[model samples]
Target: MHLLEVRGLGIRNPETGTEWILKDVGFEVGEGEFVTIMGPSGSGKTTLLHLCAGLESPSEGSVFLAGKDLAAMKDRDRTLLRRKWIGFVFQFFHLLPDLTVRENLELPLRLQGEDPAVHEGRIEEILDALELGDLRDRQPHGLSGGEMQRASIARALAGRPPLVLADEPTGNLASRAGEETMRLFREVHRRFGTSILLVTHNPRDAAFGDRVLFLFDGRLDPAHALEGPDLDAASVFARLEELGI
Candidate 1:
């Protein structure tokens, strides 16, 4: 089943009257599918993600999560829906610096009013899955970039939300670290069957997804689906060039 669907979406920056960051964007992600949104900087990839996650309202069009129309909901209802169903990973780690990894991972469950007894076991499961068991007691400041990123992901997954939205998740890591993080993402998708919508400019990272869509001037180029062997660095670079990015 399609977990997320967007149609006729458009976003405008109020300050820049001429700039429509996303224009008539549309896409769908099925359960357990890892789809990548790729484009150059300022191409509205992040805006598309924000709209999908209901962080920002679209100027035009509709966004549906699990068949519920986000634009039709009140703010409070939208907030509740996002909390219960969506998981977001930003480019920045966004972990509370003072919180230990264990505490951070538990925050979502606590907010959801899940029982503490269950949280303990769930935390352990996530820590072992992410190979982060040893770092659970460490604060964000004490962890490496990759470790912190993984912790952020762990926090996002703490509630076991079905849909995961990651915006430029690998942007700040070194090449090796980024690759490892991408591998971890694939592993998570494979094991948990979570639908992921990843926004990224890195071609190598985008290539990891089951399908890729190129965004330019706030619209998706249906003609540019990147899949299979066509996802090479050369093809991605050429598409970027064609988009004038």
Candidate 2:
């Protein structure tokens, strides 16, 4: 089964009535594949992510995750499914202020009624992988922007969810840090067979994915989806320029 699928998905801004933010967006990500969606600012990239996560209802069409239809499920069931199946990394690094880095990383496991003690080996592995060992005892407020983002990604992966949804995860970091963050995503995918769906405007960020999709003006442009040598960052940016996107 596909890890995630979107069929003719459309989302309209409730406040705006007739205007559609995303229209007829459709795609699928199979198990262990890394897929990216790139778009300009305000191009509905985050909105599409929200729809995939079942955090918002689409005005039309459907989203299915692991063969379960999101629009057909009750809100509580959707919440449970999300807890069990989806790990999300946000651009803003939504760490809890009162929780220590260790605590923050353990929060998802705790929510799922899993004991952190049993996951110590895995947690240590993540800390080492993300190079976050030094920041374990610190609070979110004490870390640099890149450090916080790394912690956020670690937290998302700690649960070993089948699919990870990242919305501009590196958008807040410096170029080097952002590149490092993308490397971590690739590493996790390679080591654990995790499926990742990342959305960002940055071409460098999009290049890391197995498949690259470009979204603009509320539509996913097929002409811009890239693979092979054409999937590099330079190629993606060049396509964007060629398309006047």
Best candidate, TM-score: 2
What lDDT does candidate 1 reach at residue 23? 89
Residue-level lDDT tens digits of model 2 in 137-232: 999998989899999988998888999999999999999989988999999899878899999999999999999998988998566688785578
Off by over 4 Å in 1: 229-235, 241-244
Model 1 has an lDDT value of: 0.87
**What is the alpha-carbon RMSD of candidate 1 to the true structure?**
1.6
Steric clash pairs (candidate 1): none
The digit string of per-residue lDDT tens for model 1 on 39-114 reads: 8788888878889888899889999998899999999999889998899898998999888998888888888888
Q: What are the Cα lDDT values of the candidates?
A: 0.87, 0.92
- List ranges where model 2 is wrong by over 4 Å: none
Clashes counted in candidate 1 amount to: 0
C-alpha-based local distance difference test score of model 2: 0.92
